[model samples]
Target: MNITRFFIQGNEACARGAIKAGCKFFAGYPITPSTEVAEDAAIILPKEGGTFIQMEDEISALGAVIGAAWAGVKGMTATSGPGFSLMQEHIGYAAMTETPLVIVDVQRGSPSTAQPTMASQSDMMQARWGSHGDYEIIALVPSSVQECFDFTVEAFNLAEKYRVPVIVLSDEIIGHMREKINIPDKVEIIARKMPEEGPETFLPYKAEPDGVSPMPPFGAGYKIHVTGLTHDERGYPDASNPETHTKLVKRLCNKILNHRGELTRVKELYTEDADIIVVSYGAPSRSAITAVKNAREKGIKAGHIKLEIVWPFPEEIIRSAAQQASDIIVAEMNLGQMVYEVERVVKSDAEVSLLPKIGGQIHRPEEFLEMIYKCQK
Candidate 1:
């Protein structure tokens, strides 16, 4: 097994990672800051004996992905805000159907074509609340190109394991920037678990003791009925029954929320004796890391939390950081989106401050350090 090194953009890296994770079907509609993901998949997937399709629109793109997932292949799609907005119905549908899939949202400026080519972390909140439901989501924010590849594979693994749609929430910079990444010859690939029960007596929606139902592939003769309607253990529509709706929805949420401890990941620096702890995700975390070091160099006890898992919010990590800091500074390329969650979790434990950047620009290390020092004061 030989390792291959490649200098490539983040979107391309993500496309390659999806293929590495055993994704056989990719359906996407091209959009700014995310089109390269579709482009690269178009080139790479067919060679791997997989299928790549450019759909009519974002809605159709995700519809195709959902179909492919049921057909027993790991499926994925990429888009920015506009396309992502269009995919919300299917996102909710995938959640309700318990379909294992991955979506790469390389976010640009939002609120309807705000900045097509610029970077922003404004979509951080949307990643959590985009779909109109109470289902839990797994969203990984990669600060660099290497993580773009790494977390794309991780997303697929999580999606298959939980049987939910996992999202890779990248920004414009990370998606477009070119960086060197080591491609492992044998990265771990996890396939969706199939039921051991025979087709003679199988109920597709029947979750195990672990609260996760195995997804048998279509044409596997399981006689399964998949739908967005409220379903029971038999996978048949049961929308009329309130108890069935409650049970199905609760299981859908509890399955991921119960596993939140393992699904969450964070990077920490100088957090033990910190007076100011900067919290960030996506590209802003890069500057947050640098600012923490710069503050430490200046004899300031500043720590940093690079939150890789943005959804399910990584509350425990923030609680840990808050235990050691006087000031919790939340920084992002937005006008305070994730700062609300940081404020909620670390309330009264640490003084929460916001270092917001808007209009598609990034905050420099020195700029964040300046804000950190001010908050320290």
Candidate 2:
């Protein structure tokens, strides 16, 4: 076993993970809290036979990654809230064109340039619906430095599998925090499936039974017509036809949504008989688990749910937890974002509550205990 271990920051781990996942092209602009990801990529990618370019802005950074993917290389980019905001339009373009790319957003306090060095999970909603139009997105939230690496690699695998962009949602705390992690010499990698047919017979946008089309890299002798407009199976614009647009859009969304069972990844602690459930992801999950253990000691029957994959919004898990627990508490470093999704899924089956902490602070286990006590009363 050729496993190497190191003590590193979450952002560094993300860059290393991208390399391990066969990401050969990286395009990014430096931004606080996430600059290290790009810095690390620039240093390591070239050594690993990958190319790294710093773009003028986040929009161009993502645009470059999208272009790289079409050229048949696994690609990635990283940013903070402001840069992530700049990348939204390009994100929509990647979704529209079904480009396989990975984006790492190390979140900070926001609406605007509120706090750069601070930590916040306020961007959770933005990740899901930041861009205009409807398309399913795959997003993962890492709670620790280790997951920052693991999730980045998984992000690449999922992106290639579904032919869509994948987001790794990390907060400033998780991004800057240092921890020891083991990097395996060989991790499972999923390559892009290519068309078996020759260029003359290949239809770029035509999907198989799995709802994914085999992609041929540029210069693979396949005359590919890539477009952001309503595209047909031939990958050409079919703008005016309502049926073409509906069918094309639905398949794009369903490629990920319909495979929700495979996309959902979560961790359950003491949830089997829990009366109070703490639903959280990213940095907050660190405190949530501690609070849950403390509650259990006091005979509170408390449990914690750590979301590894956030988007496509794991409704089934929350729905089952709602059925088992009387009160579900969602703790996040936001005013109130993901809590709405919990409420929607839980409905009247259980009471949904939010424990929001903003202004660059994470919840302490004691704060969670107080919330649990209040839930009891």
Candidate 3:
């Protein structure tokens, strides 16, 4: 499909992507770095016969999204660091209940509200394991405004396709940056599969061969008992039998892990024959790519590994890169979120070092060059 070029801010592009993905419900509170997303939804959703609610808090915002998703509508919410922290519990709920929803986290700095208006990629690990519990989350990190638009739509599609909460993890830099994005006239969108059996035979948690249960909307004839606790195929709370618990947990994890081949996506730059690899994601990755190219000019064998899908870790690719590369430098906004994952996969085989920074500042290209020099030495 041909896409038309248009200059747009990352947040605005995300909203447009969600609208294109058939999102009909948005409930979120206003937060810096992410407020533009809510604002755009407020203005555009109504025009598309969609509903937008300015919730009182991030908790309520996520709650409303879950409710709307259960009602058979594509639902989403956008927030920054503090708000993202508040919504973790509900994120867990959405995972346990197999609820399909999209969360736009325009991340800012810190363990708290460190920087409201500034950017930070510190939320990379948080997006993966912020919520309490063992569950799989699909997170997409877009580097440019165009990907911000394209990935938001893809986020919604993955959410509905997997019946799990998907997060569009952006940072303040990308969220507010204005760039030209080619918005497609007509793009492919995926919707959830409704129950096929009669109400009497329907089991909300009953797994298919692929382990994904057919979703039934709230008002649908097939009544669903959604809860955060471990449940049986019938959707009723079932904590007694270890067999049931094992099956339920396995299904939840396998539904995503088994499909890793499809879920894991990434971008590689000049990886072939590169002795040193700079691993990064989100906006920081943009700088890493430049660093790799600049290092190459100076006779350094440096390449870049840019993560598009953060969750599931892309272990296969990381492992391959680790085995082939002499050194791996992880550059991220946080002190060591994704660095740990790289270490785990790469280990002593690859000399792994973290070029860490926080508090609204990103890792500079010069820092990456330093790492490349160290790797060469």
Candidate 4:
């Protein structure tokens, strides 16, 4: 119940935040721009009487987190692009099993082993669809060291509340940046719900009106039969049955999609009566905000939206902003990955376009201002 100030890097902030959020377990393999998360966890978790393990690889890293969560501990893992690529199948499995876990991806540039120490928002799309399945994930973007702390806590909260993996989508810039984080007195921490009934009455995947089933961790003993195969309410593999598979998959997608109104959030500035809108997130958002302010001083009706919730995207908000603008300029540290997403939701006379800056750095504020000026033209 006391406020504190700490100047630290985003990765350290994320580690501290995970601890504050009551994360009791961390499983990870060291990767550039994100290894500090595991490093910090190693120091802090043991003090909290928690568990920290360095797995053989990124796949086992996530696997350990999943197994720990099933054992009833709040669990997390961190990695960069290459490591993230290895965790995809397990990400889908967490979604399928409705496991509560937090994953932090400090994005680097490109396909394989590209720019390990550099920054890129190239993984924004991957955060949502990296796994080879049709399921939704909650992805959060942190623009500053403070948000790195706050959003890591938020990721765990969302994961436990919704029974799904929540991704903390960071870039090397945000992960490595050192800044002051105002540690709050005490923040909210949410834990997963456990079954309230006897073992005989327990149903692992029962269809609830809310579409979330309470979980009973291992040794709590409600007939734990967790698996990757499509299962029914009873937690038995029913993959051979077409109906069971369809029901399970649809339920996984709907739980997040149906409640997106409550799940999605964004940061908006000067967007109400603007003629042009610059949509940006993560590190690029810092420049976008400054450029928007400078654009206003020059008498241009320019606004910006800093996307905080990337997946289960703030479609409603984007659609509304696009309708009120003359053009929408999407900016990011990648070659137009998120621009396509913006295009899908916008229905304005405002044409949507992308301002990409790849190869390790972020878009300069002046660079964004130039695109803003051109988009309105």
Superposed model 4: Cα runs more than 4 Å off: none
lDDT for each residue of candidate 1 in 259-287, tens digit (9 for 90 to 100): 88997898888887788888888898887
Instruction: Tell me the spans in candidate 1 whose CA falls farther than 4 Å from its real position.
Output: none
Estimate the Cα RMSD of every predicted model relative to the unseen true structure: 1.0, 0.7, 1.2, 0.9
Task: Give the lowest summed-lDDT range of ten residues in model 1.
Answer: 121-130
- Residues 1-377 of candidate 3: C-alpha lDDT, one tens digit per residue: 77788898999999999999999999999999999999999999999999999999999999999999888899999999899999999999999889999999998977787788888887887888898868898999999999999899999999988889999999999999999878988789886897788889888898888888779787776767888877888989887888988888888889999998998899998888888999888889888998999999998888899999988789999899988898998988878889999999887888998898787877788988987887788
Candidate 2 C-alpha RMSD relative to the actual structure: 0.7
After superposition, which runs of candidate 3 have C-alpha atoms over 4 Å from their true positions? none
- TM-score of candidate 4 against the unseen true structure: 0.98
Candidate with top TM-score is 2
State the lDDT of candidate 2 residue by residue for 1-377, as single tens digits.
69899999999999999999999999999899899999999999999999999999999999999999988899999999999999999888999998999999999988799999999998888899999999888999999999999999999999999988999999899999999999999889999998999999999898998899998989989979898999899999989999999999999899988999998899999999998999999998988898999899989999999999989999999999999999999999999999999999999999889999999999999999999999999
The model with the greater lDDT, 2 or 4, is: 2
Q: Which 10 consecutive positions of candidate 4 have the poorest summed lDDT?
A: 341-350
Whole-model lDDT values for every prediction: 0.90, 0.94, 0.90, 0.91
Model 2: pairs clashing at backbone N, Cα or C within 3 Å: none
* lDDT for predicted candidate 4 compared with the true structure: 0.91
